[model samples]
Target: MKSALKKKNLVVLKVKDVKRDKELYLHQREAMMALDQSIIDKENNRFAGLIVLPTGGGKTETAVRWVLKNFINQHKKVIWIAHRRELIEQAFESVEKNAITALIDKRKHFNCRIISGEHGSASTIERNDDFIIASKDSLYRGLHHLEEKWLKYHKEVFLIIDEAHRATAKTYRKIMESIDKNAKKFQVIGLTATPFRTAQYEKGLLKKVFKNDIVYQVSLRTLISRGILAQPILKTLQTYINVAEDVSEEEAQLIEKNDTIPPDIANFISKNKVRNNRIVQEYIDNKDEYGKTLIFAVSQTHAVVLNTLFHERGIRSEYVISNGTDLFGKGIISDSNKEKIKRFKENALDVLINVNILTEGTDIPDTQTVFLTRPTTSEILMTQMVGRALRGEQAGGTKNAYIVSFVDDWQNKIAWITPEKLYVGQGVWQDCENNPASFRRLLPLKQIEQFAKIADDTIDTTELEKIEFIKTVPLGFYSFSLEKTNEDGSTFNKSCEVLVYENNKTSFEKLMDKLTAYYSIPDAKGAKKLAKIFADAEDLSVISFLASFGFYSSNDSPTINLIDDVKDIVSHFEINRTAPPYIEFKEREQIDIRGIAQKVYDMELGGKKKKAYIDDVWERNSFLQAYFNHKKLYFRKAIDTELLKLEEPELYSA
Candidate 1:
């Protein structure tokens, strides 16, 4: 047995970490920079904020670098909090290993103590082991292991929460409140991909936890198209009418606590031998393509059943579920389950099924396919589930992941988990409605698969002369601006935004509705229900991003001319009364052929505000890009020409 001092704490740190910090991907670097800048903006004052990186976006590494910058060697106490054992373990191991080896700090003393339960380390707080890893459950059980005076030893404290969406849990709140009411905590940093922002989640919890500070977000679509994550191809496998209708009212209302599924839904989903067998056959149908598969089921019994079905079909399979024999009832993840995951990672098992075991804080990128035997409507659950396969080739992934799901709207009314939730026309989130696109009603399953193939870049559909839109979706109206000048030659700008509750059809669109503040200027005050005003008018690039990557969590370009369509919408909704205009504040139409031309030219040298004009042109021209092309070639040229007139006034007069 290895000595306690020398024993590896599941993760071993070496010179590799020093190398790891230097080898950040561009996106990871951007995340680090964003965090760093946010901190700098705080002027070393007390600050709390979040870093939004999609899973597999190197959140760990970016966090490592950020912590090293602020938390290391300052004689400061640091606490990293996580709820799950996997996350707690992963955090301790990664931070410890990376700190010892990669940081390469002058101070050789560094230590990490894992505090979870009655029998945690009782060793004295040495200089080397100031960082503490506390499971929230451990804190709730007892505070005996930690002394009140000890909290004051460090001049400052840094609290970093992993899987931070859950940081507002009751236990977490108690711990944070205790700390906040006490000593000086320098900052709070939350790292998460799926931030719970719903009205239910937001209910004054997350804001209190993070102080509602600046938020930096990077979407999964941005990372995937940039080759950072494995591309996902989600395909729907519709369930039969009988199977869909069989989920009883009780089953529909089933809930899970600590991943223990309610008995009603567990039995309902697992006992359906027909659905079980169908899902198994679906797995086998593409077994050749899916080298390693993850089967997520509704409950433990359900997972066990799926495991048996896979084995019955001669596929190597294993399963680990919650409610293990441990006191916390989470032991399945301790030995038996961990072994299965280890074997799966080693390629010894072809398939692994579980009841929400690998949803978050577990990284297994080799999962080439995800079988969604369990459905969910929660974006948090689905996002974490799909993220299992989104890790890119750099992290032992195949660069391609498939989500195989079944859609029966009646069976699972929670819109969060259905296959149809992904049907965004042109595949953009901003354009998404709560309903499935009308175009989907026209295509068969196989044709839908073809569309997914196009999404994955596995095939090209440009050769198809015409897209057969057999059905038409009713269009929502939005106002537009044509940049028209009045008869007196003064520029007039007109816009109005209105709020409507599509609660009947779009209650889930709540999150994006927060865009109200951005577009609602005080001057445009009215009943505030104007259909003409839009919050996302200036930031419409998100439309393109959605078209390319679908919803960031779940899953287009249009046929009509974009500008023409906008004009039509604007014309329809716009109240066409030109505002009175009085100009003559500005100078001449042409550049003066006199002095100051050199001054303007000199301003374009570099780092000038006006230099952005030419730079903006170059930036837009770079958009021969396929993902969310926000190219504005003519706009850039116009800005450049105007800037040039300022630079060469003499030539302008000529």
Candidate 2:
């Protein structure tokens, strides 16, 4: 066990140091120099601590350079620790070049060797080994039985922790405490991109374990501006349906406490025939356009259910969850299963889905769309999630990244990140409504209620088919009256005509009558008369009300008094011209997505009629042409020339 432990230590330090030496890239010299100085300053004694860096910033290479710069002359053993063997192997490869044959032949020093996690005895008993790599599991597994002799000789041990966020946990903390107790002279260092502990973990424990402050951090915005990372574009899918009061007070409290939009919210997002069918059938329908897409859920259970739903829909998608007894042997792909992982990366599967696992360090370069089903408040998580799709390789066929999130908590997260911090389109949050696109009509609960009633009556059509037809109707409108009283007991009554149109149509003759009657009704007596009329001829009440203004939520019965209170609120509406949903801004050096896509498409198609969805270009270029007759968006060589510099930098030589 002692021999195995020593060998494991050497592999961790050496193999990783070498792999990084090769992979390490631009602007890392200063950081490496600083880390090297820190190590040299604490040469003979114990060193255990943390190095903080943002996600996408290179922390792995910093640790590698420390080993190369400090340990080359001393020939002292260095130990690297990680929870997983894949990380150990990856680190081993990074620093592999640091290994040399001259020292091995002279019997004075051997540069590095990896200790296999599967076999504990890969370590050979050798003195003056420069570096070692070992997974924490391999070390902890053999700790009790490790030979005392091996522990005594390893005086110059350096511990490097990778993905140091987990370092605050009980197991790692215990192991480090044990190491400190036994070793006379040992040093530890930790590295992680996101080190903020979750609410469950005790606070201040991380600082206690890793005593060093973060000396350098490269923010996400900086990474994008420097062309090292992809810029993220924000977009959302919203549900405009009103909530039902059929929910219990307990459920309401739970929803409120958690700040979550209820299951009704999910129902609304899924209500639109296009959005629901589009989400489910996206993989098969757009297999060519979207080679790979990722679906992120808030929890593991959600991941499983969503995965199962997709599989049932005959979409080739899989979900990976890492915990629970039921998951003992299912879906947990071994880290060493390179062939399987490689196949997924190469698009053998239409989508490779996992919650949290693929978020941080797992690199899958071809991800084109990210579907966010869960709302997140963490800025770090939002950045990491969006960063997955924004990366583009040179000449990598035009990259079009898509994000489909519900717009509720979205604005909250956006508030944390600055407008200048954004990578792509920038303007204001309210500008989204100005875009020509509008979501098709599909009121989730009402539609679901309709289908449910039809199903109960033994209907011939499937639920999805009924949903499709309802989606096509020209208008859907519901009218209901409510009597609202002030706290002072003077009561005022209101009649509301809730309208869900076939398209985004807001004008209809029948809708005008309902509005006229609503305006005419002054008191509860008139409201009662309207209510009786609605009850007597439910279908007629709807048809009559919708005939003028072509709007409808239900074709069968328009006067359905569902959620009268909510209906009352909508009826007494006031008109205010507010800003649209999403707006973005950026500087000149940054790439403009619409600008790049339009220029590329126009050049390919050679016509203006079949222009792609360039909303801003259409607005600006048409204005430019009308006023100046220059036809600026229609292919001015100067504009295209500037775009070429932004879109195809390598092809656009100075």
| Top lDDT model | 1
What's the TM-score of each model vs. the native?
Answer: 0.49, 0.38
What does candidate 1's lDDT look like per residue over 432-472, in tens digits? 22212222221223322333333444454432212211111
Candidate 2 lDDT over residue span 1-654, tens digit each: 225434344432322222222444343555565565665655646555556654545566567656655654355556677755446655765565444332122233345645444434323424444565665655555555322434556655667888775565555676677767767777777776543332222224455565554534455455455555444444444432233345456554444333344665555444444444445564566567656777766455566566666788776777665542211112334544344446668777666566555555557777777776555433345656666776644213125556545332221111122211222122222232222121111122343333333334364333222222323222433332233434653222232334443342344334333443443323335445555544544356644544444444443332233334223432332110011111211111122333544555556643553344343454554322221112233234223444444556565232
Q: Residue 148 in candidate 1 has what lDDT? A: 51
Specify the highest-TM-score model's number: 1
Backbone clash pairs in model 2 (N, Cα, C under 3 Å; residues 3+ apart or in different chains), count: 61
Global lDDT for candidate 1? 0.52
Question: So what's the TM-score on candidate 1?
Answer: 0.49
Residue 386, candidate 2: Cα error in Å is 7.0
